[model samples]
Structures are given as structure tokens and as C-alpha cells.
Target: MKKPHLIVPEGMEFIRDDIGYAPAVLAGNTLYISGQIGRDDQRQLVVDKEAQFVMVFENMKRVLEAAGGSFENLVEMTSFHTDMRDLPLFMQVRDRYLQGVYVAWTAIGAASLCGAPGYFLEVKGIAQLN
Candidate 1:
């Protein structure tokens, strides 16, 4: 069996050293991405709903790129939302990144996420790497 490779983007070492988890793990042709919350490059939580939504997707994009793929490679995605009402705006920002490459998706309503209340969304995905 091939050994799994941990995929951590540049400047994301905190996710491993502080959080104790790989941002994503690549096994053979499959890439398993961890749930990324709405945080800026400085790790500060974003306050705006739409910006937060975009930030989380950017985080996922970074993980995918580190694994030598893009959003187009995503085969499955799961998202958690603190407020279900944000679905419409979330879908709009999501579509901007996905660009119509359809993937299996599940949106879950969560009471809270990332051990906090301010985070509005968290997204995790699986990609098939070429």
C-alpha cells in the first residue's frame, strides 16, 4: 500500500503544530481535506458573512492547490453553517469559486463550529488528484 502524504500549504504549519492535524492528506489519488473555518491569513475570524464564506473557500482552494489540484478536482464537499439562512449568499460565493463544476455536496446546519460561535461556516472537501 502507498503511504499517505500530508498536504500542508505554505504558512499553514500552525494547523499541524498547534491544531495537531494535517490540513489535508493525500493517499494515492485521493485528497482528504480538513474542515476550514472562516479566518483571514492572519488567523483572525472574519466578521462579514459573505467575506467569511469566501475566505473559507479560499482556504479550501489553498489546500487543494497544495495537493496539486484545484476546485475542479473536488468530487465531494461538505459544509457546516451556523445559520442556515445564509445558504443563498453562500451558494453565490461558492459558485464563483467552483465555476459550475458540479460536485457532490452536503450542507449541514450546526449549532457551533471550530469551538467558537463567531465562525459562520466551515467547509471540507475531497478531491481526486490527477
Candidate 2:
């Protein structure tokens, strides 16, 4: 087994320095991305539900790129939502980002995420690097 390499994208140092967590970890060719919330580049929670979904996917994309990968490299993804009713809207936003590249995905419902009230959705993924 190869040692895992931590991935921290620029401007995301707070994830490790302040949150004490690696945003993503690359073990050999597999990149395990941590759950990404609906926060903008400024780390502020996005208020619009649909836009918030976009931010979550965008954050995940940043992590994937940091690991030398892209959406095409994603093998599996898991999403947690505070409200199941948001699934329709979430899927709409997700499909826009994913385009026609379909990967194994699982959507779960949770009471809360990020240990905060503003966050309604969180997504994490696993990607295979070239």
C-alpha cells in the first residue's frame, strides 16, 4: 500500500489548519474527498438552495483538481441532505455539473451537517487518478 497524500487546495488551508481535517487524501491512484458543504469560495454559506447545491459540487471539483483529477475521474459519490424534499432540485444542479458522465452515486438524508444550521447539503466523492 502506498502512503496517503493530503490535498489542500489554495485558499482552503483553513480546512486543515483550523478544522483539523484534510480536504482530500490520495492513496495511490484513489482520491478520497471529504464532504464538501454549500459554501462559496469566500467560505460563506450560500443562501439560495439551488445555488448552494452548485457550490457544493464546485467545492468537490476543486478538491478533485487538487488531486490531479476531474469529474471524469470520479468513480463514486455520496451526498447527504438535511431535507429529502430537496432531492429534485439537487439532482438538477448536479446533472449540470456532471453532464453526461454518470458515476455510482448515493444520496442520503441527514438531520444536519457541518454541525451548523445553514448547511443543507454535503457531498463527498472518490476518484481514480491516471
Best model per TM-score = 1
Query: Where does model 1 exceed 4 Å of error?
Result: 17-19
For candidate 1, the TM-score is 0.95
Candidate 2 lDDT tens digits, 1-130: 8898899988777765666688898999999999998887688999988888998898898998888888999989999999999999999998888888899999999998988897989999889999
Quantify all predictions' global Cα lDDT against the true fold.
0.91, 0.89
Model 2 TM-score is 0.93
RMSD to native, candidate 2: 1.4
After TM-score superposition, the amount by which residue 127's alpha carbon in candidate 1 deviates from its true location, in angstroms, is: 0.3
**CA RMSD of each candidate after superposition:** 1.2, 1.4
Worst 10 residues of 2 by lDDT: 11-20
Give the TM-scores of the predictions, in the order they appear.
Answer: 0.95, 0.93
Winning candidate number (lDDT):
1
Candidate 1 lDDT, tens digit per residue, 1-130?
8999899898677765666688899999999999988887788999988889998999999999988999999999999999999999999999999997999999999999988778999999999999
Q: Report the poorest 10 consecutive residues by lDDT, candidate 1.
A: 11-20
